[model samples]
Target: MTTQQSAIYYPAGEIEEFLPQIGRVVEIKDHELAVFRTSDGTIFAAENRNPHPKGGPLAEGIVSGYYLYDPLYDWKIDLNTGLVQAPDQGQVQMYPVKVENGQVWVAL
Candidate 1:
């Protein structure tokens, strides 16, 4: 599947609040996304809800490279593609994020 869908990108917030290696939840309309800003200044957005049975908090998950580890079920979800990698797995819906002029835009 395509990484980014053709949709309007809504302004979430500035670059400062989204620190490196930290993930935060951003809500727009009926959508909720787990937005992460990597140490290298790259940003990735994905569905806040987990695919596991417990439905862990993905936003608070640990970030290692381009993968986000689920907090509850412990799944390594790809920050860019949202593919669950190895061990126990399931796919989490991924979204598009664009940073322009130090502002974060989310395409839901």
Candidate 2:
């Protein structure tokens, strides 16, 4: 991992290795991140821990468009903004994601 400005970027993996619409768990420093690649090939990263009271892993959540349906409680979380959609409340900590030279990089 390397720091650029205020964020530290870590290499997650090759871009093609991340299947679209699937979430992958990546450990960067002490942070466990749930990284997702949307169907359109955009990458999004968020804390692996769920925001719900009975928290669980977000890596196994279902991805539909830009929203992630919490695996256990089914809370719809926006990947971009980390906001739990209306009818639900709370936010997931989000990280910046980017790809360079076919390698996926996540910032924390």
Candidate 3:
């Protein structure tokens, strides 16, 4: 796990405010990130940008299982590792997320 001590973590919002399988974009300074809560109740955070040629709007992308499928081209990115899966080679910045007392915090 990435230590929370290395960087400041900002509270995005209450965890319950985000709908399941929907990615919410959170901004801290100039960084734009997509935060997601899976249907099974797992939380993930990554860059809002998609790496594919025509893919974009990651926050509005579809969440399926453990991956966030890019809306433009259907490129699936692993939410757990931020790895762009198969045929795509690259990664989005994955932020360390912590939920404490129902609040979601992202380490930026």
Candidate 4:
């Protein structure tokens, strides 16, 4: 049996404030994650996990065509890569997010 680590907690309200500015990437525990805006102003949160063992930091990574590139190893991984990064082998899970009346709602 495999044991999954504890899920990290991020205050949605605080994250929302940074959404309009430069995207913010944060790491909780050993997980790498980021919140950023596309060229079209759509905000998204994605895990920073890298497929390569020597994966770069996701917060400092780059996003291109729905994929995040590790800054250190230059590994191009899908934004939806979830907890694991692989070459068409793994997928990232997404949470339902929405902003209402100046409040951010992230379905856990």
- lDDT on C-alpha atoms for all candidate structures: 0.82, 0.91, 0.84, 0.50
Question: Per-residue CA lDDT of candidate 2, range 1-108, in tens?
Answer: 767788879999899888888889888888899899999999998999999998899999989999999869979999989999989899999998889899999987
Instruction: Itemize residue pairs with steric clashes in candidate 4.
Output: 32-48, 80-92, 81-92, 82-92
Give the per-residue lDDT of model 1 (tens digit) for 1-108. Answer: 112456778888899999888899988878888889888888988888888877866889988888887667768888877888888778888877788888888887
Reference-based TM-score of each model: 0.89, 0.93, 0.89, 0.53
Give me the candidate number with maximum lDDT. Answer: 2
lDDT tens readout by residue for model 4, 60-94: 66665556556676455555434335443444445
- RMSD, each candidate, Å? 3.6, 1.2, 2.7, 6.9
Q: Is candidate 1 or candidate 4 better by TM-score?
A: 1
Worst 10 residues of 4 by lDDT: 1-10
Over 4 Å off, model 2: none
Of candidate 2, the 10-residue stretch with the lowest lDDT total is 1-10
> Mind giving the per-residue lDDT tens digits that candidate 3 earns over 1-108?
234767788888898988999989988779988999999988898988887765466899889899988867767899988888988777878988888888888887
**Better candidate by lDDT, 2 or 4:** 2
Candidate 2: count of backbone clashes, pairs at least 3 residues apart or interchain: 0
Once fitted onto the true fold, the runs of candidate 4 whose alpha carbons sit more than 4 angstroms away are 1-11, 14-16, 19-23, 26-32, 80-94
Candidate with maximal TM-score: 2
